[model samples]
Target: MNETIARLMNHRSVRKYTSRPVERERLETIISAAQMASSSSNVQAYTAIAVTDPQLKDKLAGLAGDQPYIRECPVFLVWCADLSRLKAAAERHASDKPSYEGAAENFVVATVDAALASQNAAVAAESLGLGIVYIGGVRNDIAAVSEALNLPDYVYPVFGMCVGYPDPEHGAGIRPRLPLETVLHMNGYSAEQSGRGVQTYDETTVRYISDRTGGRRTAPWSKLMADKLTAPSRLHMKSFLESKGFNKE
Candidate 1:
């Protein structure tokens, strides 16, 4: 494999970071790479807010399930799915009133745009030898996070990312993924094949977790996922999305 492909294959989420700060130039380059990511319909409905202020990071950390890495990392970025700019552009140039306010497809487009852009940024950061972790916990309290960032209507903080030099002592090994056969189906879908693949993968995941945790844990991946799914989660997101004028139709 080429260097780029190899780097992509060796990806891992870094939680602990060293005291070293990421340079401004490097951060700019990473963001530039992010902007190069493909957007749905070329709308590019996303925005990234770089947070370097310690106090703001602290507040964000509190909002994001008290993840200390949010405060520890040299740089934190909140990626937002933004449609407010499009609204303004339409108001300025187009004759139509821009019917994005209540459209579900528009929300999906913005969210996908934000996700693609953030992933591009992550890959760029990793290529530069920087460690990073996506902070999805920001969604635990989306309203609070939005308020903290002063997000206006038609904008939503999709997630945050912490970027810095990895602490060697706290480095994480790559966790295994499902076999390609499980995900890559030929022509038509097969439930039997999927079931067989998952069953085999459950065994693999159990062994992997046991080894990774030094035998401290030994539960099948299916069980863990089942437990997670059983728990209540993010019911407020529906109302919150409506309040943000998404999916109103």
Candidate 2:
């Protein structure tokens, strides 16, 4: 396989990092790469906060359910789904835009823009031999995160990224993915054949987890995923989006 494909196939989330810092020149390059990601309607409705403040990182780490890595990472970036810029532009042009309540569609567009940009940054970082991890737990306390970041209306923190050199001793290996046959469908869908592979998948995940974590995780992938989804994860997200000035037409 080619180098790009190799890098993609070997993708793994690195949570632990070495103390080596990413210099400003490299940081600007990564941010430039992130900004180059395609945006919806050319709105480019996203912004990234390059956080290096120790106090702010500690506060953000707390808001992210006390995930120590947030503060420990050499560089932390908070990506935002932002409509505030558009709102400001409209106001600056003296246009009379009405009040907006975020719709599902608008939320989707913002999320897509932010996620694409983040992935681009991640790929760029990895190519530079920098280890990185996406911190989705940034949304665990959306209100607190907003307060901590001093986000204006119409902007919401979508997620965070931790970037640094990998701590060789504690770094993890690539995670297994669902078989291509299980995910890739032809002209039509096939649930029966799709369902058949899940049991084998459970066994695959069980073994992977055992080897990777040293026999610490016994539950299969399905069970672990179910536990996370069955609960009220992101239950407040809808209202939170509505609070921002978006989606209302």
Candidate 3:
């Protein structure tokens, strides 16, 4: 495989980090690379808030389910899906004030745009010998996080990312994904293709978990997923988003 492809394939989520800080210049480069990611209709509805302040990081860590990596990492980036700027811009330039920036379609566009940019940042950080992990727990207390970040209307955090040098002693193994056949489909999507490899994938995951936990945990992928689905996860997200002026209509 090519170098870039190889690097992509080798990606692993790093939860523990060394004390080394990411230089401002390098962080700027990563942000620039993130800016190069594709946006729907060039609206570019996203903003990344890099938190280097220890006090702020600690507060955010608590808001984000007390994930220690957030405070431990050199940089904690809160990637926000933002359309507030668009609304302001429209208010300034457009003759008509009848705009729908808060539409459901627009929400999807902003969220996807933010995610695209965040992934680009992740890849760029990885290229610079830094490790990164996405933190969805930021949404656990979405309102609190928004207050902490001072997010305005038409904007909300998509997720947080912890970026730094990975701790060698605490490095995690690369978790295996589902078999290619489970997802790859051609000629107008076939359910057969999707289901064909799940059993095999479950077996692979069972083995992987067994090895990772020293035979202490051997739950298959399907079982884990089922449990996750049954659990009440982030139930406040919908109401929280609505309170923050999202998905109106």
Candidate 4:
């Protein structure tokens, strides 16, 4: 594989980090790389807030499922799917209020934009020898998180990320992914191919987890997935989105 592909394949979610602070210049460069990510229709409907204050991080860590890494890391970035800018632009250029305030498509586009930008930032940080972990637990209490961040209407904190130099003592190995055959479809699509591929992948994942966790967790991939899906999760997201002036229709 080429150098970029190799680097991308080596990604791991780093939970532990050294006390070393990421340099301001390097952080700016990483943010610039994120800004270079492609946006749907060039709307670029996203915002990233870099928080370094220890007190703020501590509060955020508490809000985000008590993830200590947020407080420990030198930088915690909150990625938000933002439509407030669009609303202002619409008011200035076209109308008194934004027309796409409650459009589901706009919400999707903003979320996609934020995700793409965050991935770009992650890749760039890794390339610079920094470790990063995405913190989706921020969504556990979306309203509280928004309030803490002072987010206005039409802006949702989709997730947060912790970035810093990895602590060698706490380094984790790369986790396995589902087989490409299961995900990549040829021509149109084939359920038989997907099913067979997933069956094999289930076995592969069992072995991987066993090896990774020293056999502490022996459940098959399918079973684990079934258990996870059986649990009610993020049930408040729909109403939360509506409250944020999204998907009102």
Instruction: Identify the leading candidate in terms of TM-score.
Output: 3
Q: What is the lDDT of residue 55 in candidate 1?
A: 98
Q: Which stretches of model 4 miss by more than 4 angstroms?
A: 96-98
Query: What C-alpha lDDT do the candidate models reach, one value each?
Result: 0.92, 0.85, 0.93, 0.93
Comparing candidate 2 with candidate 3, which one achieves the higher lDDT? 3
lDDT of 1 by residue, 81-102 (tens): 9988888887788856555545
TM-score of 1: 0.96
Candidate 1 clashes between residue pairs 3 or more apart in a chain or in different chains: none
lDDT of 1 at 64: 90
- In model 3, residue pairs whose N, Cα or C atoms come closer than 3 Å (at least 3 residues apart or on different chains), thus clashing, are none
Native-to-model Cα distance after best TM-score fit, residue 63 in candidate 2, in Å = 1.1
lDDT of 2 by residue, 36-93 (tens): 9999888888999989988999999988988888898989999999877776777777
Candidate 2 Cα lDDT to native = 0.85
Candidate 3: segments with Cα more than 4 A from true spot: none
TM-score of 3: 0.98
Model 1 lDDT, full chain set? 0.92
Residue-level lDDT for 82 in candidate 3:
97
The clash tally of candidate 3 reads 0
TM-score, per-candidate, Cα-based = 0.96, 0.92, 0.98, 0.97
Cα RMSD of predicted structure 1: 1.2
Output the lDDT of residue 232, model 4: 97
